[model samples]
Target: MEGELQRRVGRNLRAYRQERGLSQEAFADVLDVHRTYMGGLERGERNLTLRSLEKLAAQLELDPLELLTERRER
Candidate 1:
């Protein structure tokens, strides 16, 4: 369950970032995080804290819950 949630967050983050036309390195710069750390997050290899999640959401102009919620296919 934990791993699944991590992957979900990763997928959502990647999708949202792509939607904004940002590369992982650029997004990491916007978030003031390391590029490697951003890569880890996008790969679902790192666990995210609530505060970090909120920060990421805020940077993306998204509600924090949106990061955790599963996106439906069109």
Candidate 2:
């Protein structure tokens, strides 16, 4: 369940970043994190802290809960 949630968050993050036309490296810079770390996050290989998740959502102008919720196709 934990892993599934992580991947869901990663997918949401990736979608948001892509929607803003930002690359992983650029997004990482905005988040003050390493590009490799961003890649890990997007790939769901790294676990994110609650604080970090909030920070990411804030940067994307999103509610933190949005990052956790799964997205469905319209």
Candidate 3:
């Protein structure tokens, strides 16, 4: 379940980044994370902590719940 959730969150992050037309480097800067870490996050290879999620949502202008949910952009 954790793996699946991670994958979904990774997909959501990629989708949101694409929607905003931001490169991973730019997005990592905005999120205050290393580019490699962001890559891992997007690849579902890392388990993000709650604090990490909060920080990411704050940077991304999204609610925390948005990160927890997986829905294709409309």
Candidate 4:
């Protein structure tokens, strides 16, 4: 279940980033994380801490809940 949440968050994060015209490498740079690490997050292979989530949300100009939202059609 946790893994599933990761995937959902990752998918949403990717969408949000792309919508803002940011590449994974560029976003990673903004987050001060390695590009590979950013990829892992986008692929749902890495878990993010609350601090990381907050930072990312700040960068994206969104609320943290926006990142966690599971927008996939049921």
Best by TM-score: 1
* Model 2 lowest lDDT segment of ten: 11-20
Model 4: per-residue Cα lDDT over 1-74, one tens digit each:
65997887789878876877999999888778899988999999988899888988887788999888886643
Least accurate 10 contiguous residues by lDDT in model 3: 1-10
lDDT of 1 by residue, 1-74 (tens): 65998899999988888987999999899888999999999999999999999999998889999999999864
Off by over 4 Å in 2: none
Ranking by lDDT: 1, 2, 3, 4
Best by lDDT: 1
Global local distance difference test of model 2 = 0.88
State the weakest 10-residue window (summed lDDT) of model 4.
Answer: 65-74
Clashes of each: 0, 0, 0, 0
Q: Which digits, one per residue and each the tens of the lDDT, describe model 3 over residues 1-74?
A: 65988887788888888888999998888788899998999999989899888888888899988987988558
Query: Residue 44 lDDT in model 2?
Result: 89
In model 4, residue pairs whose N, Cα or C atoms come closer than 3 Å (at least 3 residues apart or on different chains), thus clashing, are: none
- Winner by lDDT between candidate 2 and candidate 1: 1
**TM-score, candidate number 1:** 0.90
Measured against the true structure, the TM-scores of the candidates, in listed sequence, are 0.90, 0.89, 0.89, 0.82
RMSD of 4: 2.4
Candidate 4, superposed: residue stretches over 4 Å from native: 72-74
